[model samples]
Target: MDLVERLFAGDKRACARLISHVENNVNGVNEDLKKIYKETGKAYVIGITGPPGSGKSTLTDKLVKLLRKEDKKIGIIAVDPTSPFTGGAILGDRVRMGDLNTDSGVFIRSMGARGHLGGLSDATSAAVTVLDAYGCEYIFLETVGVGQSEVEVMKSADTTLMVMVPGLGDDIQAIKAGVMEIGNVFAVNKSDRDGAKRTKREIDMMLDFSKKDWRPSVTLVSAIKDENVDVLLEKIFEHRDYLLESNLYHLERKANVKNEILSLVRKEIMERVINNDEKHQLLEDLSHKVALRIENPYTASEIIINELKK
Candidate 1:
C-alpha cells in the first residue's frame, strides 16, 4: 500500500517504520514525504519547550492522559541531547513518558539532537510530517532551550507553549527574550515550588508591556499532582480556535511548507555539489590556498561559483 493510505489506516507499526526511515535520512522517504505533502497541515501541531528540569516531560505525560480521555489520537516527539559517542539521548525522555506509550491512541518518539544547533534533531520536521499524515489530531513536540533555531517549532505548530518554573536562576530570564516571543501560551510548571506565584507575576508584567493584540495568558500547573492541567487543556483548545478565527493558522502553515521546501532544496544541492569530483577538488585546493595565504576566500568563492555554473 502507499505511504499516505498506510499511515491513515492507523498502522502503528507502519508509522514507527516510517519514522525510523526519516530519522535515518533514507533517500526513499524524501520522495515519500513529497508525495504526502498535501496530506499534512491537518494535524494541530503544538510545541512544549522550556529549560532543563522544568517538568516538561511530566507535564507532557499528564497532557497525553487528558487528550487520550477525549479520545484524541496524539503524537509526541521529544528532542533530547545526544551522547557524542553513542548518539543516544542523554535524558531518556521516552522512558520518562512511558505511561503514554502503552496507549494505542498515543505514539511517542524520542530523538537525539545529533548536534543540531536548535536543541532539535535535524529530522524533526520530517518526523512531524509523518505524524501529521498519520491522522494524529494533536501532535506535541518537546524541546529544551530557546535557541534561535528552536523557533522553527513555531512555524510547524498552531500554538507554541513555553514551559517554565519558579526557580532556575538567570536561565529563566535568559530564555524569556527568545521563548517568550514565540509562546502562544505560558505554562508555569512545578507550581508547588516556593516562588511559583512570583514567577507568574513576572510573566504577567512582561506580557503587559507587549503591544500584540493577542494576550498569551499564564497558567500555573503542578504536573506531579496534575493540578490545573484541565485548565491548560482548555486554553490549548481555545488557542486553536483563536488561530482559526484569526485566519493565522492557514497562513502559518503555508509559510512552514515554503520554508521546508527551500531548506530541503538547499541541503540537497549542497550535498550534490560537495560530492562532485571537480567541486571537491576545487574546495580542497581552496583550503590549501587559504592555509598558505596564496589566495583569499572572497576570490576563491567566485571561482567555485563560476565553475559550478558551467
Candidate 2:
C-alpha cells in the first residue's frame, strides 16, 4: 500500500516516514500532503512552550499518561534545540519520555530546530497535519524552551500553554512582553519550589493589564511529582470547550491555514533566490553594489525581486 493508505491503516512506521519526509522537505511531499489534507482537522493541537529548564518534558510525560487513561490516540512532536556543530538535537526529549515508547496508543517524534529561530522546526505544522490524518485524537507540540521573540507557537496551537518555574530571578521580567502574551493557559511548574506563589502572582498581575475577551488561567503544578496535573488538564479542556462554544476554534483554524500558506510562499521565494544560478549571481552582485555604496539595499532588493518576476 502507498504511504497515505498505510497511514490511514494505522501503520506507525508509515506515519514516522511521512513525518521525516515533511521535515526534510523531500520532493513531492507537498503533493502527498494535499492528497490527505481533507483527512486532517480531527485532532486538537496543543502547544507547550517556555524558557529552558522549565520541566516541559516532564509535564508532557505526565499529561500523556493522563491522556492515555481516556483511550485517546496521541501524537507528540518534541522540538529540540539543534547543536551548532553537529546540527542535531541535544538532550533528546525521547529519553525522558521513554516509558511511553511501549504504548501503542502514543506516537512520539523528536525534531531538531535546525537553526529556525521561532522555537520550532519549519516542518512542525506539516508534521501536525500528518499525525492528525493518521487518526490521532490529540496532538501535543512541545517547542524548544525559548526566550523573547520565539512566540510562533501562538499562531499554530488551538490552546497554547506557557510553562514557567520559580526562583529564576529576572527571567520572568525578560519574557513578560513576548512569551506571556501567547498563553491561553499558564502553568507554574515545580510548584513546590520556593517562589511558585510569587511567580503565579506575577503572571496574574501581568495578565490583568490585558483587555482580551478571555482571561488566561494560571495553575500551579509539580510535574515531577505529578501533582495537580489533572487540574491542569481540566484547564486545557476548559479552554478547548471555550474555543468551540464561542466559535473561535474555526476562526483560529482559518488563521492557521493562512499563516501556513504565507510561510510556504516565503520559503519558496527564498529557495528560488538562493538555489537558481542566475538569481544567486544577482544576489552576490547586489551585495557588492550595496557594500560599495553604488546602490542602496532597498533598491538592490527591488532589482532582485523584479528579476525573479522575469
Candidate 3:
C-alpha cells in the first residue's frame, strides 16, 4: 500500500509523516489528499475561538488532558497571528503546550494565520480532514480571533466554542457581528476574575435574544486551575451526542464536504488564472478599469469567465 493507504490502515507514524508533508505544502499534496478524502469524516472537529488574550491556548491544553483520559486519539490545530515582520507564528502556544507535545496520543500543530480571516490558517480545513481520515476521535481547532474569515473557515467544525473574558468593554462590540451567531458554546474564561459573573450575565442576555433552535450554553471556567474543565468537557460531549441524535451529525459532514470541495476549487481556479498570462493581463486591465470607475469587478469577472469558457 502507498503512504495514504498506510495512514488509513492505522499506521500512526505514517499518518504523522503524511501530515507533516502536507503542512509543508510539498508537491503532490493535492493528489495525496484526493486519495484519502473519501476515507475521512470519522473525526469530530471542535473549533475553539474567541477574542485574543481570552486564554484559548491554555484552555486547549486543559481540554487535551481531559480528552486523553478517554483513550481517544486527538489532533489539535492552533492558529496564531503571523509576525508582521517575520510572517511566522509567534509560537507562544508552543511554549505553553510543552509537555502536551510529549504525549504520544496527542498531536498538536501551531499554524500562522498567514493572513487568513476568522483565525484559521489556509490549510487548517485540509489538516482537519487529514486527521479525520487518520482515525482521530477528536480534532480541536483553536482560532486566534481575527474576524469574519475565521468564522467562515471554522464553520466546518462539528461544533464551535466562542471563548470570552471579562473587561472587553466597548471593544466587545467589535466581535458582536460574526462571533455571536456562530458559537455553539460560549465560555467565560478566567471565571475567578471580579467581573466574571457580569460577563456571564451579558452572554446569557445575548442568548435570550437569539432565535436558534438549541440555545448555546455559557459556562465559566478558569483554565489556569483547570476549574470546571470537566464540566466543559461534558458539555462538549453533550453537544456531540445531541448532534448525533438529531441527525445533524450527518448534515454537518455533508456541509463540510461541500465547503472542502468549494475551497479547493477556488484555490485551483485562482492558481490557474494567475498562471495564465492572458488572463493575468486581463485581470490587471480590469483592476485599472475598476479603479477608474469605468466598470465594476462583476462585469470584469464575467468577461474573464466567458474567455476561460472558450
Off by over 4 Å in 1: 2-5, 84-88, 145-149, 170-176
lDDT of each: 0.82, 0.91, 0.81
Question: 1-310, model 3: which lDDT tens digit per residue?
Answer: 8888898787777777777777667789889998888887778889888877788888988988988988899888887888777776675776667778888888787777776655677788888878888778899988876444457644678888888888776335523666667888878999999888888888888788877677888899999989998898888888888888998888877887788789778877887679899999999999999999999989999998888788
Candidate 2 per-residue lDDT over residues 175-285, each given as its tens digit? 357887899999999999898999898888888878998898999999999999999999999999999999899999899899999999999999999999989999999
Among all candidates shown, the one with the greatest lDDT: 2
- Model 3 reaches what TM-score against the true structure? 0.90
Cα RMSDs, all models: 2.3, 1.5, 2.5
Model 3 is weakest, by summed lDDT over 10 consecutive residues, at: 145-154
Q: How well does candidate 1 match the true structure, expressed as C-alpha RMSD?
A: 2.3
Error (Å) of candidate 2 at residue 199 is: 0.8
Rank by lDDT (best first): 2, 1, 3
The parts of candidate 2 lying over 4 Å away from their true place are: 170-175
